[model samples]
Target: MPVQRGYRQACGVARGLDIVGERWSLLVVRELLLGPKRFTDLQQALPGASPNALSDRLRELADAGVLRRRQLPPPGNTRVYELTTWGHDLEPIVVALGTWALAAPPTPEQIFVSADSAMLTIRTYYVPTPDQPAQTLQIDLRDHGPAGTFTAHLTSSGAAVAHEPPEQPDAVLVTTTEALLAAFGDDDVPGLVAADAVITGDADVVRRLLSSVHVPPATDPR
Candidate 1:
């Protein structure tokens, strides 16, 4: 691929923009945030982009040193793309952007998030309360089609989220995408449970986990 044009300016922000300013570049970064992905996986995660566009963006990001292509060893020897350490540093930026964007009401057109993206959104929106005791919970979230597992560790000071399941989670919650989204939309745990969402282990811990993340109302601009 031929080289793309730069901003031709000396500012740091401009330099940063020159590298990731192209459309779909950051979204590519978002797809790789959880881990490596094959080209087809990326295509599935970002269905809006054409294959050629995805390929070009990957090439651009690789050339910019934001991503690298590697081949898996032995059994699964397929080539996949992953972010470099520097690229991984973009997580905070992406999370912050998501938090900011959530304030806006979703339009009818927007739909679907990759399993990882949904987990990451939970991590991004989670806020620990001062009075709440520290706790850990595991979530086995299922969509109507696919499923994923995650763990959230919360404390009075802060909270952390991991893609893996906790060995001895204080609680485990299982729900579909629609139910989970509804929970996040209104902090409605009973509603979800009534709708067939399952809860195992300590119910209080699950409550704490759900309460930690605060999603603004649909009418709230801020």
Candidate 2:
């Protein structure tokens, strides 16, 4: 589909931009990277976006074949937007973009970070190590507006996160986004546990997992 006010360039990057260069276009795709989300979920994730603006972006993305809306079956009937097969292909691109952004300046204090974005942090900064044994972890993030449960798989090569709980995880970390970020950025598990964070399983798994995250420093160096 043709985008409005297109760059009208012949290059591949320009062409791709023409489709997703709008303000919140790529962010919309980012929210759906893990799985489908209801309109309310998107709103919670992107508080800066006006309802009308978000609607317009969603429509445009649907037209561009990046996402599709579907209704859930039965008792939990609700509409949700999910990335199409072609849309899911944007995951690596989004990850690369996020990784690229790590070199940029630190964000201002109290900036909002959606749960999906928090999960993406895991994917973006994942470091594989032979000493880091494979394990399944259940992550429960609360008080982040529409709390999220995720299952993370740490492998020899990489880590994978899904928006679902595991039947039997090797460890479970329950914490708020702030504490989780603190742990991720500083690997401060004991501090987190002393605060609002809770751990039900192997603490070493949680420690190793948090230590494995290589996020940019929260404070500016300059």
Best by lDDT: 2
Candidate models: Cα lDDT each: 0.78, 0.85
For each candidate, give its TM-score against the true structure.
0.81, 0.89
Regions of candidate 1 where Cα sits further than 4 Å from its true position:
1-5, 129-134, 144-147, 185-187, 216-222
- In candidate 1, how many Å is residue 77 off? 2.8
User: For model 2, how does the per-residue alpha-carbon lDDT over 1-222 read when each residue is reduced to its tens digit?
Assistant: 436788878998888988888889999999999999999989988899999999999998998899999999989799999999999998899888876666666557646778888888887787877866689998988866344788889987888999989999999988888778767845678898997789998988888788888886534435
* Model 1 C-alpha lDDT versus the unseen true structure: 0.78
Local accuracy of candidate 1 as per-residue lDDT tens digits, 1-222: 213777788898778888888888889998888788899878877889999999999998999899999999989999999999999999998877777787788887887777667777667667777887778887776762333677778788776777678888888888776567667634567887997889988887766666666765556575
Positional deviation of 210 in candidate 1, in angstroms?
Answer: 1.1
Q: How many backbone clashes does candidate 1 have?
A: 0
Q: Clashes in each model (backbone N, CA, C under 3 Å)?
A: 0, 0
- Which candidate wins on TM-score? 2
